[model samples]
Target chain A: MADIILNPYYMQIASFILINIILGISIYITLSTGLLSLGSAGFMSIGAYTSALVTMKLGFPMPLGIVSGAMVAALAGILVGIPTLRLSGVYLAIATLGFGEVIRVWFNNLEITRGALGIPGIPQMGREITGSLREFGITPDMLGLRANQFSALILFFILLILVILTVWFFVRLQRSRIGRAYAAIKADEEAAEAMGINTTYYKVLAFAQGALVAGFAGALYAHTTSFINPGDFSYHRAVEILIFAVFGGSEVIWGPIFGAAFLTLMPEVLRGLADYRFMIYGVLLIVMMAFRPQGIIDYQVLDWLKKKVKRNKSASPLDKQKGGDA
Target chain B: MKKWMKVVGLIVSVMLLLSVVACGSQGTSGEGGEQSGETESGEKVAKIGVISYLTGDGAAYGEAITSGFEMARDELNEKHKGELKIELVIEDSAGKRDQALNAAQKLINSDNVLAILGPTLSSEMFVVGPEANAAGVPIMGTSNTAKGIPEIGDYVFRNSIPESLAIPAALKKAVDEFGIQKVAIIYGSDDDFTVSGYEVMKKAAEDLGLEILTTEEYATGDTDFSAQLTNIQAAEPDAILASSLYKEGGLIVDQARKMGLDVPFVGGNGFNSPQFINQAGEAANNLVVASPWFPERDDAQVKEFVAKFEEKYGKQPDQFAAQAYDALYIMAQAILDAGTVTDRDAVRDALANIKDFDGVTGDFSFDEIGDPVMEPVVLIVKDGKFVEFK
Candidate 1:
């Protein structure tokens, strides 16, 4: 067991986590706006292929390649989003699905995306035994630290900062007037439209933000995996991200975290289960939805937790009468 | 419940159950996708179907090999008159087992091919090979490298050596030639090809008394290898025996080099492609691989075949193409020998008794399990070309 834990495969599991965390955070951004535009996977494929092409063909510096990949993907997201913001719910899902499929087919046909041959030989980032800053002579011992501990530390913290930034923005959005506008859109768009909130603009912003995160994740994934194919970023993967958002409760800041953790570990935990693993996954999804329709902990539960102290033990008749009247 | 609603609900449940069953068995790409489309068959021609993963993850390999096979079919059709006309129908497996199996059924039942060329995944081969065999059709797996596949049925045939034969000798050759001691075995944990090859390598490595210093596993979709390379670097193995297909193999070698893990990397049959070279850049120049086909062989027959293939495709054919070329020749031989395509049983029996039929992959002969009994080619990637080594 110890040997397995220290195996390089474990490092790969961490790699999976790094990419998923980026995606989870990306999905988290859209969930915050109360608008699940559901099209980030398209952007992910765009970024992945872009980084793969640049890195493999142009030989750009790893960091530059990743950033450019993300930038290109975000641009694509903006382009796709401009035409898709008018649809709501099922219509939005269908359009986004079309976008995903279009990217898939385009990648399948484009000579540049290698048209399914897939781009290989991407330069890997982060070190296994040594941290990057150590190359500049700031060894862990020199900085009073253990060696090899922080060489790839920046990548993780980069992901952490992304998550933190997204959460902070989300919480801020939840409290702001515009955030309230998003909530109104989520709860009832018709009333929000009557109230003068520009639903289209907010929805477009939400889609753009979500797509941006997916692109960032995609770029990071390209650098980390050092290889990618059209198969990696498919419509099924978009659903995986949605599953992550929903599984994490979709209400609290840590919802994506919960979802990412579960999905990431679920496959590993079920490694012993072999072919039965996917069946179990489907079953788990059904069980979770049946028991916890709003997810394990959503906004309502958190609000309840906050107002738990010093409340009247029972509803007074006047309060009850007021509640009943309402 | 209302009658129609209850009927609809039952239909939905049955659909789900049927899909689950289909997926579990690894045949048919769901219901009515292609099976219904196979309505006509040419009785005069010997029709063969290639259920290949032509446009997805393994697309490069599939496309490359099929190019060679397709070329052979064109040339064969030109040569043969009314006796044994060979026709190949290209269908995309999309790397799905059910799809491949469904393709096999369609080819056999509707297209009524005397033989089928593929179902590339070992699991898919497991699913479809038996049925093809039972129906008296010989299945020539162009690139199913996983061992024990021929056991699916007696009528199944593949043009490549199984892992048992390939892995042990390949390792012995590496150990003898490279003088390697410790080895780092890296493979994809998800796919049966890599996993099966890894298991064989594990035993062969142990039996050879080589130390398994670091065994790293990565999922099929994982692209990052820094941490794993780091750990392998720390272990400082003399060689890295990677059981990966082209894309991952390219990334593994590239990353291992970037991390300064400068050991020579050895790959399985998956490395026998031009795409790997294109992907691995200069780093692929010195990579060693154990393959089943050598495009640059000096054999008289080989030279002629290579000349014909290159002339037709306008590019050098990879191992997959060579293997598929051999597989098609094998079918052609059986068909010509049997003297009729309508007697599927005779065709299957003729293929079963095949012996010493010199083809591109090598002397073709089928073991009792219907697998090609052949030797693995020793290859070293040199300056954007595959050079055959002793």
Candidate 2:
């Protein structure tokens, strides 16, 4: 296990899985609020191109570039969400998909984005961190590692923190007043509105938050991969993210994370199959849907697991007392 | 509910177990006998990696290229006999950049291949080429012709000629002979290859004192070119220059001809394949293209390669296959010259220093940046075939 973890090849795969998990969670946020906005890839593209340009063109610090990327995407998300959130279900999905295509086409024609040639040679985050550390009196020999040697590890830790914070945020939101309002809107928008909940605001809020998360993921992806192109963020990518959310059980917060990680790792693990990997992957997905259509994890399964743990805890003392009496 | 969950669990576990067994069997059958293949001279076997899109939109190119690699591998093994046996570890990239990166990483780290042959497309190359260069693994691109590919690093090399060299040669020849005074251009704006090709054509056209009437663009996978053709026809230029892949290029030509625009059409490297002619049929009659390889050349090496490739693959080899076939032989020659495939740096230096190496395309040498300096041929479609334009 240590050997596997230490391998740079596996590290690259692990980093990729982390990035996809972030993207999955982005779409999951919107699905949880009952709006299937298929526009995370657009926000991601905005984030990637913005952060890349900020770093490469302006020579800004990496953290600032990433933050600005998320902020810009959030702004764009709200701008799009204000008018489009009125539509529901497939209508909203189609609108968001159109928005995604518009963004890609804009990137393709924009001179600042270098048109279709794409902007290459974006600086990696690992290199910037190491350079700062070295300037602060850390010896290179003491570190005993190259810039990219620790890149995947740094990305892993960053993703770990982001995931933990995101999960915590969603759990807290599920219990808060806004969270209940979102739940009511998702259950029945007209009923929720009659019950004095502002469905429009909450739905739009959900879209904006989802965009924010996706944009942040895109920023990280750009810095990690050191390359960005319009083709990288297309309708196909958006659909893939939706699949991650749906396949993992969007009803629960953990579903999209599991879905993203599992799907991303599946192809890498099946490397031995050569060209037949995708066929086997399709077969497995079909089987999975046939068996557990709701998803691998859902709210009901979580509730059942909670009950099982509680029963075991409550029954332990009773069994102990009976044994003593006997 | 509980029964259903249990059944589902059982099925999932069974499928996973089956796959694990399949992987185990393949590993044992493929690489398990490497130890016993060593000769009395204590020379170890050489392992080379091939990465290409075996099953996707670009799979046709991948199929042809891999076939070429296999043909060359078989011939090398037969020629060398017991001295050195080349073991190929092939991986599929599916024409995606991330998949290509993963394939390259696995090839370099796990398979431990001395060198990698291809990742098929230029977009894939832009992402994985640097990764291989950083890992100190030499990668030779067979079909990557976009600009800045060889500029990826010192460890990167390509046998395919870039549009910068190929486009100018063909454009100059067309203008000088055909007397094309004014020209209109159309290209796939979304793709790096077509975009770069358009850039080269634009510069070359201006350099040759040709008037640029208008320029039009379309996305890849778009079959309808009637609108773009009508717009270009309004310009009424002496000729039309198109920078597109074979499929769309053919459609553009057919549509333009059907619209009664009877001017000559000059194309970039993307139309080099015979598929362009096959798809456009008689409409491709006057279409001229710039390419690095023409199988009909009267050369012994070219004849043998064309015959062997046709015999093996049951189809005429395109420029993509020709380059791939040449790439494998070049790698073999470099290894033989270096006398050790285990030393990657030695092989890279030897590969860079190759001079006047004869290939099916042309006799070329690697420049300082590891790009091939080969002459691009001007070919025209006549009588449903590609022949020298002259």
Candidate 3:
């Protein structure tokens, strides 16, 4: 099992799945606050170019580049979120959609980012981080890993940590005062503002948080793929990111993770279908939506499952047997 | 709840079915490899993976490339007879970078191919090239004409003429033939191919001591070129140099003609297609471009290949098909020369050492950096057909 999972083929797929899960959760953050911003792709591009350029030109280490990428994206998110957050629903979506195009065109024309030519040969996180560790007299062989396996293993762990951290952050945020403010704003923006809840502050905060997560995901994505052009982040990508949250059920943190993992793996699993691969994938998504309009793991399903488990534990022996039979 | 259960069951069943298919394919491939080995017929089989846009917007190019490979495969197997056999593993990238990367990874790791042929576009190359190079597999680009492709790694190779070579050759011919003193430039700025081609055209025009009047840019999917054509007309240059794909390149030429800006229009490799003439119609006349493949060339080999291709595909072969045919033949020759079907390192060396190999595209060889070193022929559109420019 370890060998199968650690092989280069599965490793590549695993990395992509993890990156997509991060993107899924990133959009989920904004969706939870009821803000339909189509700017995740823009924030992702920001993080990608920022880290790529800094690491390549300024000699920043991979970790630093990743952080700076997320930070810069958060800053842009704040700048974009402040003015655009006032517009609700589809209007905000359009504004953010335009923002995405503007960023794409900006990178296309910029000389430093190499326009549409893209920056290739960016250092992979696994090899670069492992090489630096070797300089400090630690070696991958000591951990029973080959050179290639060592790099892939390191990248896998880094992404795993980021995934865990994002999930934990959301879990905590959902229980806090800001989370309630977000819920309130999402439930009714005018009412929340009437109640003096500082709706704009919480909305902007949610947007920036979403941007930060997306930016970090993008930074890692660029390093793993080792190439990025302006075309990589387009309007289609923005919509795809939103689909992750929508498909997975935006109400819970696990929804986006499940959604991202399923969707990302579906294409690879369907590879044998050749020309019909994407067609089948689209059909599957349609089927999933048709079957579960509120998504597979929405609040009602969870509540029902919880009640059923409780009843199973407390019922009489005869009732328990009947329940089991049913 | 029942719907959810049904959906879950469906997902699980589909996954199981697909896994069985994947395993079944792998099993057959293994059996085939062993069967080839066991046969005392002295026949060798080489697996070469092909990644191209078999669907989506770039499907036209992909279809042409696929047909070219199929034709070359049929001819090579028959010609080589008992000595060699090439088994191609074709994967569609759908003209996307991630999909291209996934295709390359699958080809390199799952299929265990000795080499890879293409991912079509240069943008796809930028992503797939590094992956193939790192895996130590030789990948040759059939249609990636962007700059800095070969620079990705020693393992990367391209037979397609880069715009840097084609654009300069076309401009020089235009300068000598038309005696043009000045030129205006227009290109699609959103694409890597056209942008690089534009950069090459600008430098080439300046190098030939021609004055550039004005430059205009448009996005790739844009159909209206009147705004940019009007700007070019206002500049009043002797000729208009354009670096764009056939879609926009044709429209720009057509728009320029309608706007009464008639001078010889010199274009990069993008304008070397029959589709360009189809798009521009009568306006296509006097349009000049450089190409490595010319079906109308007075060569017996070229004529035979073109005739055979038309018979097979029931359509005229374009430059893309010609290049792809040449690329596969080049791969087969290298595999035969190395005398080892599975040893990739030996095959890579043989491919690099390919010298004076004649193909439908003309005599071809790889320079020090794995870029094609061949003279491109200058052709002008005349009466909706390409003819050798004097």
**How does each model score on lDDT?**
0.70, 0.85, 0.87
Candidate number achieving the greatest lDDT relative to the actual structure? 3
What value of lDDT does candidate 3 attain over all alpha carbons?
Answer: 0.87
Misplaced by over 4 Å in model 3 are A130-149, A190-196, A301-326, B1-40
DockQ of each two-chain model: 0.01, 0.45, 0.45
Model 2 gets an lDDT of: 0.85
Better of 1 and 3 by DockQ: 3
TM-scores for candidates 1 onward, in order: 0.51, 0.93, 0.93
Better of 1 and 3 by TM-score: 3
Judge candidate 3 at residue A231 and give its lDDT: 87
Consecutive 10-residue window with the lowest summed lDDT within model 1 chain B: B30-39
Better of 1 and 2 by lDDT: 2
Candidate 2 deviant stretches above 4 angstroms: A126-149, A304-326, B33-41
Candidate ranking under lDDT, highest first, comes to 3, 2, 1
What number of backbone clashes does candidate 3 have, counting pairs of residues 3 or more apart or in separate chains?
Answer: 0
Model 2 CA lDDT for position A27: 91
**What class would a CAPRI assessor give candidate 2's docking?**
acceptable
Question: Interface RMSD values for the candidates, listed in order?
Answer: 17.9, 2.3, 2.4
Residue A234 displacement in candidate 2 (angstroms)? 1.5
Error of 2 at A48 (Å): 1.1
